[model samples]
Target: MDPIEAAIEEIKSLPHDQSFTFSEIARKHGVVRSTLIRRYKAITEPRTVKAVKQHALTPDQEIELVAWINRQNEKRLPPLRRLVQNWASEIAGKPIGESWVGGFLDRHQDELIAKWTKGMDRDRHQADSWHKYKRYFDFWHAKMEQYSIEPRHMYNMDEKGLMLGITNRSQRVFTRRMWEKGELRSVLRDGSREWGDYPCHYL
Candidate 1:
């Protein structure tokens, strides 16, 4: 039970003729006097209870939504804000306001986060499996051993083409824990073509 709730119970257990004032009891329980009075008099319910009564999604529905978001993120298809809003509307059986998603995110901040996703080529995404990576690394290690290669002998070279004035970034929601562990960030996209042919000469 919450400390304040426990304190309220204790206050109720006190004898009617007890000399302890409501303020004194509130102080002893480390709770606000006004809040204690309100609760003691049944003038108001707990904030959490009130919030539940007013929230569009029930506790169980919210949990389902959170799970759905995480599943989508795991599949590398994290949802956009508008998409989330639509899903929430479906769950609530009514359209939600623009600000509802913001509040929902705040409520589940520990488990979910919104971020702008980096675009990853579909080919790269398809190759980002554990089996493929392990196979590639095993082949690389075998080649290194055959050649007696040392780390100091290795020189890495990379070449990338950029299309000027083109961006594929989009804001999406992801699981906060996965994001922290560097598991979620990129959104898959087709990289076969570029919007522009502007040359960026390296200096």
Candidate 2:
């Protein structure tokens, strides 16, 4: 807004009591507080505040901007966005430019993401097949009836730990952008590992 016109408007609104707000000027006359301050150089600052660099974001302001971006993308109420902008400006420790508030997401587009939730891989556990052994049960029942044999008279025989010497090998996978600056490691076979490699070997 033109400064000369804003000065005239504020002068007209001035009553016997010279108490008003800068926000009132901004809304009523479409004039920013800085323009009026420039016009009326002798205006007393209402609050005690140290002068701060304009448009430069403080560490706290940066975090508020990030929060604003997330809230805007969340499809929330209009008041939420305005609250975020207000919070961001206050957190900046100075009057922040409107462009800085609006352009935060655009300027940091790569950093802000519209993710609904944390990405996760869902795993479905499937059970392996089990045998009913219906035919085997029938055969055993028939033999018992034919020979009048009891289950107590039967002998059980099976090999235990037949695959004890056999080993299963597994491979490790890495997909990071950068790894340690060293040799590329490959998964070795299980047989390559030995119990005797331990320093404390016992007889």
Candidate 3:
């Protein structure tokens, strides 16, 4: 079953008392709690869910999320509730909820996500003589060979690329707590990863 669909059905099967909190569902999936939030609602509606699966992270909040997640390291990742709270606080330029921190963490499975994360630096430029003058690179390469010097001068000759993926859509909590099958996908996106549709075959 689809992750989101299965999540919803699971939530519906649960008792209403427990259904009101997404943390419970997140734990079941072993994902962090933020996995459940979407837009102004913690639970993503089908409409928003469709957009996300399509890889459209253009929503204002989502865009902001990508920027923040990309710049930080996975090690800086705090507890789910704290992560969400910090996300809001950082984006809104003010403190929000402390409880949200924990709620968010419960949504994602830490183990599976151990290698998944946000942010990257891709704008660093290298003054490559290769592009300016084909002969420039050859000259450097040849020069280094003559002196037996390490080709550190032209070691790196290309610019880096940055790709940010959607971690959470971010939703508002209507009731006291959050409840939803917290399913977060640790997606990686960059120019190379960009495509009009999902690849036909999964790697």
Candidate 4:
């Protein structure tokens, strides 16, 4: 079951007495009280669908955007942020700005990441051809298997240029240390072990 649905069930299972507030239900179900309240209202006011707040893009529209982005990426042709903003404006039939882009990015952060790429970077100057990358990957995988090389033994360092024109968001500090043989090495991002960092580290 969905976590939200489970939370709804938990709220329903609670005693009818007003003694237990939404906070109590939230704590019991490990969900935010605000989320619980929203779900409760949703359940009790099913007819009030129009009152629900929604993002500018409908769910289907967002899915279409996701597909378009993925297709662009598969062709090694990433769309610029400004291009996305223009697309949004075209869809809405009005000029949208950076604020809309920022909110859209925030809502879809789990499915996408914001990366800073140098405009003059030669690494991505040419669009990657499928056959070329496939050949490279096949050779790389064969070499890895022959040497029993594991991903943990590999590390990549890429320098990201600081955008002088834009304001910095937050500072990131990276510390490195060599580990002894047979010792487990741990890596973290944002000063804590986050599962999201695993994919970035391996890549």
Candidate 5:
């Protein structure tokens, strides 16, 4: 609890004939006397609690908005700022200001972040599923066993390609949990043909 609130509670708990004044309780708890008095008399609530009521969306509506953002992120299609602003406007029954999105993002920074998405080829994205990777690894392990291959003889190859064109990077909102886990970077784009490849090998 806040120091002012704690002081107010202490004051309220005093006996009717006790010799404690608001100033004494405030000094004891290291809070301002006038603030303690206001709080004790129920003249105001904590600033953090009051700020919620002043938000464009109600608490319940903001929660629903967060849920929608999470669902979009799970589909690998996070919403852009304009889309979020429009959704918030619809929820609040009024058009939000240009700066509302920034404030909203700041308020929910723990749960969300705005990030530039890396482009991924549609075909490559579709082919990179769990089952396909598992099958490839399983077949490789079987072949290694059949050939009696030693670990020292194994070679790994990695291919890096550069597409020679300007690619647009759009900012999208994603859950901080996914970002921390390194899962919020890629978004599908059209296949590219103008490319240069460099191959590296390691054993």
Candidate 6:
């Protein structure tokens, strides 16, 4: 049975006593007192009330779009925002822009997640395939025992870019002296003056 219908029936089943108020019944049945009263009245009046506003896409059509997105995810190739917008426009029989897409996503936030994928160079991504990494790790682990190699010897290197300050030229920072000593404060060097190499060791 529908939950609302079931709740209405449960409310009716309560003892006909003044102690069992509408608030108590509604709370026990997991519904608002106003909603329970409305449903109760609708039961006797036999008239329907329009509850929700019209949506751009019907619930079934939205579910179909969500299914398509899940299918794309299963294939490990999610569609781009533009592709989704075009698809929605095709289904909607109108030009759907970013604003419409955003609203649609907001409406169906429970079934979808917005993600920003990091940009990767095509050549680098191709060389970093899962199968290649698996093979390399398998070989490395197999030779570990023969070479008496410990986990500390294994390491990975990553390179990243850093942005310097707004101006390229160095600037002096003014500060109050403790005792007016002739010696000035230590120079604050810019850490982004050159490329940095980070070593990640595995243990």
Output the number of the lDDT-best candidate.
Answer: 1
Worst 10 residues of 6 by lDDT: 171-180
Of models 4 and 6, which has the larger TM-score? 4
On a 0 to 100 scale, what is the lDDT of residue 119 in model 1?
Answer: 64
Report model 2's TM-score to 2 decimal places.
0.22
Q: Model 3, clash count? A: 27
In the range 38-83, model 3's lDDT, one tens digit per residue, is 5225455566567555432224754465345433423222123346
lDDT tens digits by residue: candidate 6, 1-203:
65556777876786788356778777776777887788788743322223223355666776777677666544333455666777777777777676666776776666565544333334334545567778977988877876778888764321222222222323221111311232222212223212234442333
Extract clashing residue pairs from model 1: none
Residue pairs with backbone overlap in model 2: none
Pick by lDDT: 4 or 6, better one: 6
Regions more than 4 Å wrong, model 6 = 1-54, 122-203
Which portions of model 4 show Cα errors greater than 4 Å? 1-54, 119-203
Which parts of model 3 have CA positions greater than 4 angstroms off? 1-63, 74-84, 108-203
- TM-score to true structure, per model: 0.54, 0.22, 0.20, 0.36, 0.59, 0.35
lDDT against the true structure, each candidate? 0.74, 0.43, 0.42, 0.52, 0.73, 0.53
Candidates 3 and 5 compared by TM-score, better number: 5
**Local error of candidate 4 at 155, Å?**
37
lDDT of 5 by residue, 90-135 (tens): 9999998858888888988999998764565655556556787789
Give the residue spans of candidate 5 off by over 4 A. Answer: 16-19, 117-169, 180-184, 188-203
Model 6's TM-score against the true structure: 0.35
User: Once superposed on the true structure, which residue ranges of model 1 sit more than 4 Å away at CA?
Assistant: 1-7, 14-37, 117-169, 188-203
Among all windows of ten consecutive residues in candidate 1, which has the lowest summed lDDT?
156-165
Compose the digit string of candidate 1's lDDT tens values, residues 1-203. 87679888997788999867878878887889988888888899988999898988998988999999999877656788888989999999998886888889999999999986456565555665778778977976776787777767754331222322345665678899988887653232323233224542222
